[model samples]
Target: MAETNATILIPDISGFTEFMTTTELSHSSRAIHMLIDAMLNAIGEEYEVSEIEGDAVLLIKKGPAPSKKEILGICLKIFNAFHSQRMWMQQYTICPCGACKAIINLTLKFIVHYGPLVELKVGRFVKQSGMEMIVAHRLLKNSIDSHEYLLMSEKLLKQVNDSTETADMVWGNAFEEYASIGKVGYHFALLNEARKNVPAPQAPQSYYRKDSTPYLQTTIAANFLDVYMVIMNIPGRAEWMPGLQKVEQDMPDICIGSLHHCLFENHQSTISPLLMISSDEEINYAESCRIEEMNISLVYEFVFKKVDEKSCHFSVRFMNAAELPIPEETRGILLENMQRMAEKLKLFCEK
Candidate 1:
């Protein structure tokens, strides 16, 4: 048996569960096999796929000094292949609802490292050992759990010079601890660009309605408010208000239990007032309170009048402390806080 050091590549599908749940068993099985075939074929062109570990495919290439550029290019090609298959599934497959969600809407994580390739004499078994493999496995695991689109180690990055395309594409430092791998740092890379030749999927225009009850809306809002209060330590009775107490017992129906649900669903829920308050800008006219201190409320509503057209409007209003019956001076403080919260919400929804 010949033992040598080489780069190991691992590529795993992202939305395996989504595909299995939505696709027919036979179709799902075929898709999985096809993906594996495509990956193995692409890797076979430049390296040997030593083993297929369930959903993940591992490849090894013995070197004549393979550059980081070469490794990145190979990884990109593998990603493109997966992307192509995903498009095919979306176009041809039918789901329970006559519409199929993409199974390959996943990204690949690559681990490129150099280590000793050991072969056991008792059997025809070959494996990699030492710090390189350990680092690679650790990095790969971390990347998967973090849902990173792509991840690479620092040692992997240094093999390529700054002038290289790989260096230019690296956006920013990834996980600090991973980036602090000193000679073996980790970074993320996106694969969508490499598949430019492939047609992109059309964005779905249809909207699905979840719940539209005021109680749900208020519940969602209270959840968000609690989080905000905890983070900022706002000095007020709002943290211990009876309305918030009621909402706490009943969790919000919104996704991730966020007040953003009210915005996403529009103000159709009845409990929305408990969650949010709407007032006219006229309240600010007579009040000397700063905008941040006033109790300003915002409502986000989305409506789709046509199949391809949708309108999203966010309405903001300020409530006078006189109307809420709170202290006059506290009005400006509450308004300012509400405005800040609105800004943060805008940033989150935009993304």
Candidate 2:
């Protein structure tokens, strides 16, 4: 027999009504469809979408009660996906009205609970009505008024963890809230682990210049620039060269893409290529071509020349593409994530 498990329902919209009043109905409808598709794709195959309410979508994912870590991971993935879509949309001439507003528009609310209910199938009509479902709907509505990204029963939160830290990465303030839902009381905290994970931005050791034009400096130590370039073109290699112009043009997008990939993509092992070439003969032009074809852009290259028994001089160059500009908020998020990556790399390299 299938054990009764808790369900996680997320109802969200792009706040189209507020910002998309000028848009044609057909275009707005298509945009909602795309949003739904993106949500379904991100949540995996297990969850069943219950309904669509205007621009909002309701999704139900059935599973044995998820751990707090698992719940946090799922929420992070959803937020990251929404953030990416918002950024992509901003690139277009037509703004999705106020759809891109992270403060008031681009937010999602989730309601989760355990229930002893079953879906009723009546010919072509499907029924998923239950006390739990009703509660989920009510909570979603409450979330809108509360201005909170997530709301759950104290019972659910306690089942997930005794206590969790809530670090405000965006606002730089940690907050804790307690909730009483039904007969349960639970405490909730924001997750600010990302701040601890990111390394502080460091000064580059050397700056690259092309025809008297100087670009940002590069560092041997793992920094945002290194991680941004490496993961964007992961499972590939980078070199210092004058011909790589497109890579530079797409640097901002590439950085954003890498951030999206890291936060969303689930993989068992690291995807970066090993830099093991000790001699010039080991570097093959054909292999470089194959790597580049993988869509991995090498934005910077480090030429390591041995200086002594334990030190070396590193020469670095930025790739030659047009520079892409990101919004202040997006840049802030990237910087936070970059610091986290740097800390992790520091730990790994030490070992």
Candidate 3:
């Protein structure tokens, strides 16, 4: 056991419980994980992430506490990152499911505390345990009126001062009682004003021209969601699309800015999500790809129309390839390959 002083910062996703319970599990789970990743990225190398507990991420910095400005800067960075991620996902999302649509309701709050930490090593993992740690975790259940805010423990606030030079935050004081620790006082600042500074998501890339005609179209004997699952499943692409050896991405779930390096039997292509829009009646998706060997840019577009509760009409086209002046024989070969792939996709979705 190593006993030392440390600063504990927990970034908790608010409304996570209701969001997950009420929304579609498959999509909601992915959305939450992606938002958490955004916060982790913004935190960068400043703090050590101790553990992730469901909707909360526990981070610690051993020895010494950061100044008020430093902590506020970190919190603002995380807030911006979180909201920015949600904005982009909401803008380009193709899934009209409950989870994707309800993402806008999810928000964030942070708890900061400074105290003695007991570093206990169990197996390969080290756990931070102590009365202060308990106090920090307990503070999460406080009466903070708003979902988006920063709450600093009395001990920490004393060290860093309660008043901040950051003008946007609206500060206040509150206290929570626990059986073990009695009353713990804290100061909180609403982040609604800070969020106003978060930039809006950029427009989605337009890969396909409006006048492009479909090269092939088909109807899938499955619901819209089912067909979408099959299409967005990158690893499963090998099963339906021909010559696809493997697909790789840094993140597990697909989103607006996702980049996938697809390995084919004969060549490699870098592909990125271009456009995605969805509604009850119809859904649209597009991707832009650059073939390394051919040195040609191509856009793949898909439009899905709901035929009924159990079936959908799917149309696919290759756009912006006319500028490449692809030979007729090459275009024929490409069309044949896509036609076969579409048939296989339909079967895969139906199964």
Judging by TM-score against the true structure, name the best candidate: 3
Task: Indicate the worst ten consecutive residues by lDDT in candidate 1.
Answer: 280-289
Which order, best to worst by TM-score? Answer: 3, 1, 2
lDDT score, candidate 2: 0.41
lDDT of 1 by residue, 215-255 (tens): 11111122232223222222222233222222221332211
Cα lDDT listed for each candidate: 0.46, 0.41, 0.84
Q: Model 3: per-residue lDDT, tens digit, 1-351? A: 899999999999999999989999988988988899998999999999999897989999988899888898898898899999999889877567899999989889999999999999999999999999999999989887789999999898777753347654667988998996899998888988777889998977654555545558888999976787678666679777888999988766576667788899989887777777778788788887787676667778878889999999988887654476666776686678778878888998888
Give model 2's TM-score versus the native structure.
0.43
RMSD of each: 19.2, 18.8, 3.3
TM-score of each: 0.47, 0.43, 0.83
- Candidate 3 residue pairs that clash: none
Question: Candidate 1 or 3, higher TM-score?
Answer: 3
Candidate 2 vs candidate 3: the TM-score winner is 3
Model 2, stretches more than 4 Å misplaced? 1-4, 14-23, 93-104, 143-148, 162-351
Ranking by lDDT: 3, 1, 2
